[model samples]
Target: MSEKPISKGKRSVVITGASRGIGRALAHLHAAHGFDVLAVARNFKDFPHHPNITCLPLDLTWSDAIPKIIGCLNATARPFERLINNAGIQVELDLTRDVGDETPALIDREIALNLTLPIHLSHAMVPLMARPGGTIVNVTSLTSRQPKSSAPVYSATKAGLASFTSALRHQLAPLGIRVVEAVPPLVDTDMTLGRGSGKLSAEAMAQAIYDGIAAQRRIIAPGLSRPVLLLNRLLPELVAKILAKS
Candidate 1:
């Protein structure tokens, strides 16, 4: 990815789940490019950041804090031109016919964190994106297209974002607010440590992500993720079998 050009004219950017993984990489990349970064996460204090980065300790899962946090971001001279909604969880929701549970607790939790929180954040940020060059980069997963048996709810949430990315691209295009999906393959993060194979380094994934954003590629995937997406399109059932084996 081309180094985020200083000409991009970004004064500030907001990235969630910035304690580690891809979120942290993007934060550093933005800081290096002279963009003030607002990093939000549960353990944000643990992450070291550049002078330009402001760490906001926020639990996005706490539904009530959304408006207040967004207000703080908006009360600035320059609102965020880039918004990366990467705060999501990989939850295990094993709902089966024989299962006896009072409620679909796992499914509800996944929807809240993985889907609802991001949606709420985006809704709050849309008004701040009054400028002509705003961007929204959602860090989704490869499992959106290759859902396996172990984490159906996780995949479903990502798949929803994938679809939202497409529709949002059209909706926001006229307004100049580009919505892109950073669909990563297995990366060397705690989220995918035991779940993925042939993982790419976080730095490499970060580079690809920024490149895709600068170039405005709607679906961003590094390493072999693009090929895998293509293969799944051509041979979905075959790809399912392979993913099931994994």
Candidate 2:
């Protein structure tokens, strides 16, 4: 492991989109693992009330989201040990201008939530991250390695994040922070509902992610991600054809 092992205890973990799916599972998993979890989500009505979990209700797409997050951290008077940029949106829009009924607003929102927000959050959280053992986990997708025609914008954003994660890893290495790019296969979540079959459960994916972080891996590609990525490298066109249909 190139990164230092994270010390166990009540260190804070900030997770975006923690109301459901992978983020929610991660919040609970970390809390169970002895980390103080700060769950950030717009909806908190169904949030799991745990002693180690604190809910922060705010739209991550808002203009002042970063400031509000920073303010919250400052109020806690504690540097977070981990920041998981897990909030993202996927919109199926036809880019063809003539027959397409796509809204520009939706496209902007998707990009903002998926790509732009993570970049800004990573930068803002640097100072607030615990030194020497701080870790940043950026959740990307297999669609990142290959573009998906159905969710073209989502593909683009994840691809952008993947590149950013690599560069950030190098940049933060000297600063004693570890940046991890976590790639999960299609999971059984609201996002993928009715779209894919044989999806991995969010709980399982969360466990894989936690294990990856514990192992201090720079790139945590879980489930089919490892094989898909290897195949993509050897046969880009074939993989692209398969993922485009996914």
Model 2 per-residue lDDT at 158: 97
Off by over 4 Å in 2: 1-9, 97-102
Clashes of each: 1, 0
In terms of lDDT, the best-performing candidate is 2
The TM-score leader among the candidates is 2
What global local distance difference test value does model 2 have?
0.86
How good is model 1 by TM-score?
0.89
Output the lDDT of residue 33, model 2. Answer: 81
Error of 2 at 71 (Å): 0.5
Give the lDDT of residue 205 in candidate 2.
90
- Candidate 1 weakest ten by summed lDDT: 1-10
lDDT of each: 0.78, 0.86
The whole-model C-alpha lDDT of candidate 1 against the native structure comes to 0.78
